[model samples]
Target: MKIAVVGPSRLPIAPPFGGGLEVFVHRLVSALRLRGVEVDLFAARGSIGHIQSLEFPGIDWTGFEASARDDAYPPGAMESEAAAYRRVRKLLERSDYDLVHNNSVHPAMLVMDPGKAPPMITTLHVPPQPELQQIVDTLGPSNGRFTAVSRFTADQWRIPTPVDVIHNSVDTDQWRPGPGGQGVVWFGRITREKAPHIAIDVSRRLGLPLTLIGRCVEPPYFRKEIAPRLGPDIRWLGSLPPEEIARTVGHADVALVTPEWDEPFGLVIIEALACGTPVAAFARGGVTEVLKDSPAHLAVPGDVDDLVRAARAALQQPREHARRTAVRRFDIHTMLERYLTLFEGVLTR
Candidate 1:
């Protein structure tokens, strides 16, 4: 089947350039192709080179965050987004693909009509965004099926139709066990919602050095909230490539996840577990779903003391057990199989 995988148009599909959603798209496209499925990736410029691509314009959220004064959307940003959607709609209208998999939460949801387009599946990677929610409502039940990355997200978002939980995945072979050293590790977008500062506090409270990795989206947040906290004990190494991240994080004794928002899926947690690293995270959104088997490690959301205590307990958990859990639950092969099933179902229905 010829599949058109519509990737997030906000950033490039390459690593260290985009966040969770981009990584998911890049991996999915590559895996689908490897399985002998004819796939075409529709992503922003500068995406993976090996695959067939249809490049589209994308608005850089990092650039918007840097220039905007208030929490409001930057000028001309929405206009450009609309234009991109029009472009995608025109392409879909003209193309002949068996299935179109949308991995974006933008105007494409508003512009593309399932009745007029090929068999399509839109994956909701994050919790309810107002515009995307409006589009889902407008599209209604019979339009298309929506998939959520986690059950918590599916339940919380409350889309008109039942949303399937197809949890995000990681490559276990790429992120395997190692002789973990002392100190805690934290990684993800360095925005306030991710709360890298909380990880710094936890590291300081425990007297263990902290390693921070990820791209800083909000410059002011980084300069004011995160930059001031950096020192010999607290280090922010910025973003690293996937292989480098696995290698660097594999040596860490524990992975500290401090998300201040309702994260749809804690990809970092699974990645850490894949590296035989245990996670002590704030019990927020889908975090518990990922670490349900290791419940002692989850603390009350935003509670620093509780998180610190949980981290202490998490350090004692068996690394081999953590790695095994990751292999059983979040492996890429399982994710790919589930995705293929979804695509075939969509086409047949």
Candidate 2:
């Protein structure tokens, strides 16, 4: 099967910028090629270059920053993204792809008349905000199919499109448990919504040294809301590389994931699990789904005391059992196979 994957605009499939979506695209393309499927990746410019390409057979990486293009859309925030979709549409028009899998939320999907194009499938990683929701609703029917990373995200938007739930997977081998490192770990974007403050409170209450990893995207808010409370026990270690993250998680006695909002999916929770580290996250959104049968513990959202109790319990759980759960359920192979089934179904239709 010949497939085209459209990735996000801000980051591509290379170092320094690729986040969860980039990792997903790269892994999916590599896995598909291993099964003898031909794949073409369409990503943003500078996000991926020829040298950093994945050396998998039957896979091609094409870099184009449509979102950066002036002619792609009006000179606005999403102009380059719109331009990218226009380019993707043209590519589909002139190519023989069996399916176009769009990973980004591009407005151009609505502009393209479905009847004249090959079938397209989109995976919504994040719940759409109100405006994006309108765009998705307009393009949903024409897009042929839709998949959400989690049921919580799918329901949050109340999208009219028929949706399938496909949970994200982790590379179990790469993230497997190593010797526990130093202290407790709190890794993710340092936003109020993620509840870093809760993690801090928990760490303080337990007297366990906590390491905070992730970029502080909002400084003013962090300074006012989060920074004033930091003490010697909490070390703010910005974002680290994936291997480092795994190593730090492996070294940790427990990983704290206390989110203030209903997180669509807790990628960090699964990653921690893959490292054989038990997680104590708030029982909300997909956290419950991910930690459903694991040695991990869940607490009520925003309750620091409950979170502290859960963290203490996580520290006491058997590490071997946690590792087993991660390998059995959230392994990359399992997720890859599920996605393959979905892709094959789309191709056959």
Candidate 3:
């Protein structure tokens, strides 16, 4: 089947990326091509090779950093996004693809004239934004099929359009078992919402070394809340690529995934599971969904004491069990199959 995959224009789909959406898109494209599906990726310039990519010009995520800090959009952000929409619309008007799979966070839906285009499906990778929600509401059911990364994220949408839940996937083969060491690991964007501080607290309570990874999205939060706590026991390893993360974090005794906000999905936790490493994560949003049937390792969100206790219990949980269960539920193959089914169903209707 031929498909037009609309990737996020804010960032190129490359390694050491700022967000998970870009990585997910790259993987989806690779998986689709391996299955002999003709896929066209609409993404930012300078994206990595190996796929049929249609580059689009737009402001990167760095342009919106200030607005992100203030919980608003940058002044020219919308204008840049509009230009991207126009480019995509023109391409769709000319192309004869079977379907368009939009991964863009931008409101491309506004430019997607359903009258002239093939069936489209948009995946909501994040919680609903006000402006995007307004556009979805305005379009109603005419905007085509919608899917969310998780049920927790789907529930956050106030729009009347039905959203299917499709959990994110990880390549289990690349994240094989490692020789586990003495400490626990924590990784994510070093923003306040991820609550890296809580992970440190859990480590300290149990007297285990906590290796912290990831880039600092909010400098002030790291300076004010996280830096002071850094010491011999709490090591800041900084951000590493996915291959390195699998090798490094896999060796840890356990992983601490503490999210202060309602995380749409915890990719870190699933990656840890794929590495045969037990995870002690807060019971919030998609954390519970990802850790289904592994309730013994979950603690209340932001509760350090409970997290410590859970981590201790999780240490005794078999490493092989975690790897086996993760492969069965979250393997990339399973995710691809489900997506293929969804795409075909949408076309058939």
List candidate 2 segments past 4 Å from native.
Answer: 16-18, 49-76, 159-161, 226-231, 294-296
Steric overlap count per candidate: 0, 7, 0
Residue ranges of candidate 3 with Cα displaced over 4 Å: 50-78, 159-161
Per-residue accuracy of model 2 over 1-349 as CA lDDT, tens digit each = 8887777665557643335676777767777778888888777656543122421111112333222221133234355455556766775766788887877665565455676666778788766666667776666566568788888877876556678888888888889786664768998877767778888878889888888888665565578767897778878877677788888889999999987778878888888888878899899897888888843488887878888888888888777778888888778788788878888898787
- The TM-scores, one per candidate, come to 0.94, 0.85, 0.92
What Cα-based lDDT does every candidate model obtain? 0.83, 0.73, 0.83
Which candidate number would show the highest TM-score if scored against the true structure?
1
Error of 3 at 250 (Å): 0.9
Error of 2 at 208 (Å): 0.4
Worst 10 residues of 1 by lDDT: 64-73
Clashing pairs in 3: none
Runs with alpha carbons beyond 4 Å of true place in candidate 1: 50-54, 60-65, 68-74
lDDT of 1 by residue, 91-196 (tens): 7866799988888777564456656778678888877888777766776774477898999989877578778899999989889886688589998888888988
